[model samples]
Target: MNAKIVDQHVECYVRSLLPEHTGLLKVLEQFAKLHNVPIIHPEIAQYMSVLLEIAKPTRILEIGTAIGYSASVFASHMKRGHIDTIELNAIMAEKARETFEDLNKSVPEVSLSIHLGDAKDVIKTLEGPYDMIFIDAAKGHYQTFFETAYDLLSKNGIIVSDNVLYKGMVATDDYIVKRKITIVKRMRKYLEFITTHPNLETTVLTMGDGLAISYKKGILNE
Candidate 1:
């Protein structure tokens, strides 16, 4: 992310840098770091930007809104849509509010709303039809998030899940007993179930800690 100051600094300083920029990208990143917002890696954020641009979803439901860095990225690329972000951490929710307040005044093209509660519970209150769903919250709740996303997404919609690899821990032997093994294994199981499902077609790509993209066809949920 040498192209962007946020990338360079977050990498050098926090080591959890994500692909972002200024003008718009930087403004959000600054607020995130300023509030100690836990954001995604730079490379992943860049990739996510492209994904959002390509999909251009009218309604996007983001499971996690840590300081709003990624949400900002999506907001910047979403030419005509708004973002619905869920942040369970009160500190993070408050930080994201600051970031949104700053953006709402300057960047009028995008609007952001926050759901303050657990993603799964908050998701139930949401009435659907989100064209895009981003699952990036707790590592252990991936499976449940999948089920919820399926129920919320519109027809021919797409869902993106992050951090499936957990820093390559999923590949280790079972006997090793990794701290996050159970969750990681469950994530893998969820991935397999989604990829093999008849209604949804999924392709897990090896991009920046692994991202699983699932595309759902038609409306079959009852």
Candidate 2:
């Protein structure tokens, strides 16, 4: 399965067809690279842009805001939407706030606010029914995130979980390292739960690291 997934060369070729980032986005991408922050790849961002273009969600709930790269991307593409992103690390949250301000200067149609705290705790306090819920935080807590997302998501809404495959380790135990066994195990469980849940319909895409896109079972054609 991993062999069938896009290779580095193919991924690069696909990315070449996408437009180049400019302004703050370019800077954020560079900062993420320098700081070793785990931001989505450009191709993944493009993939998400296409989804947002179609969904046109008015309100988005983001579980992770690692310097706000993905949140800013969500805002920039959503045209008119509000994003509430949670970040546990104070320093990263501050940087994300700064990134939001920078993004606002250009994409003024979108609004973003950073919720600083553990997402598991913070999610409970949020008033939701959000159009979209994006989970990209700690791999071990994805199932918990989905539980919160299930309650918060509106009818016909979508739930997108990133790093679901964890570099394909979740697909097979052969690639799982000692340090990542727990994360891999948890991710596998989360994938199984989401894919098999009667209330949800999920498709795990091989793009980027890996993305699991799910929606309520009855809403696909609606």
Candidate 3:
């Protein structure tokens, strides 16, 4: 009866109907549930997988690596890409390393890289020019992350940001969540700035929580 349960159910049914998951990804998804990792919704995972399959990017940089659920899902579909995923939580990072190692048994082709630290500090040290950048780290840090995202992104790279809607709080009046106002305001500001930024073309899709897909548009301009 709850909205969160409804969302979860819908995502489950959609994943059930999807036709293309290979063996490792299916098992990896199951593991996500058993451990209660709170990876992206299944519909969102499908979106992420489809995008990876289509883009066929050579390199991906993910700012969050929570238990490596999404990272494994992404790896299973990435035929020849390298992934550099970061996690600020040391325990999660260690567990993620184990997950990636376990996945290596069946899905051995992917180059899964791990970075454990605050992304802002780690991003600078990372060898970038990544074709895909997925931001799912701290919510309040989205804007700070976005600023560097543009710089590290390749000429025609893509950026996918998760949870921009903040459980539908951004649209409500200020009194709704007066206590945590700072994050809501910052999220709205980031969304607004990203939508209007000249170098990128972005659309906020409402599939799950909300996904902000931004594509660098310099090639289209030229």
Candidate 4:
């Protein structure tokens, strides 16, 4: 099944135009491709790099740390910051640790820590006023993750949810497979909540897969 939410040709063209990934990011991209590990799309990574530059977040909380690819991206872009990333699988967490260790050598200013546990459980244990929260974990549990992490966000913080379109499945019933029905439904509900909540102002972009960027509204002007 083609799990791309964007049109294949358009995605390909956009990716082709992106500057080549270098150093650790290049290596990790190759590794993810060869090993069939899921990481953020190159386009998403590029977009995130721009977002990081503009936001200049000092503290970031990442819900998924697969091979630490996205977390590495976040770390590299920051001049000085700390990242707390959660990975559910122990092996993946260990792998992420190695990635962070290497990243430290090159980008020593940013601190990256991998917390090994279910995101739902680990998020509760965190004391945070994070400048940004990036969610790219289990598809079905996004709402739970968002709700659980809401209090941890800093006043002007943003939450970026990835793969919300779920390969276009969440956009319509036509793309949903039988086994993914529950996930699609949940994703729809999550989207609805984020879009309509009075405390949030969200913009859903049909970029890589999909990205729902929600800003905490109550304190932005103050």
lDDT of 1 by residue, 1-222 (tens): 012223345446544454436665677667556766667766678777788878888789999998877887787777777789999989888878888887776667888999999998888888888999998999888888878767788888999888766555554554324465678688778777878888888888665566788889774565
Model 2: which residue pairs collide? none
TM-scores, in order shown?
A: 0.83, 0.94, 0.86, 0.96
Worst 10 residues of 4 by lDDT: 213-222
Model 3, runs deviating above 4 Å: 1-16, 19-35, 219-222
**Greater-TM-score candidate between 1 and 2:** 2
* TM match of model 2 to true structure: 0.94
Better of 3 and 4 by lDDT: 4
The collision pairs in model 1 are 17-42, 18-41, 18-42, 19-42, 21-26, 22-26
Between candidates 1 and 4, the one scoring higher on TM-score is 4
Q: Which numbered prediction scores highest in lDDT against the true structure?
A: 4
Per-candidate local distance difference test: 0.77, 0.89, 0.82, 0.92
Per-residue lDDT of candidate 4, residues 45-159 (tens digit) = 9999999999999999999999999999998889998999999999888888988888999999999888999999999999899999999999999999999999999887899
Poorest 10 consecutive residues by lDDT, candidate 3: 1-10
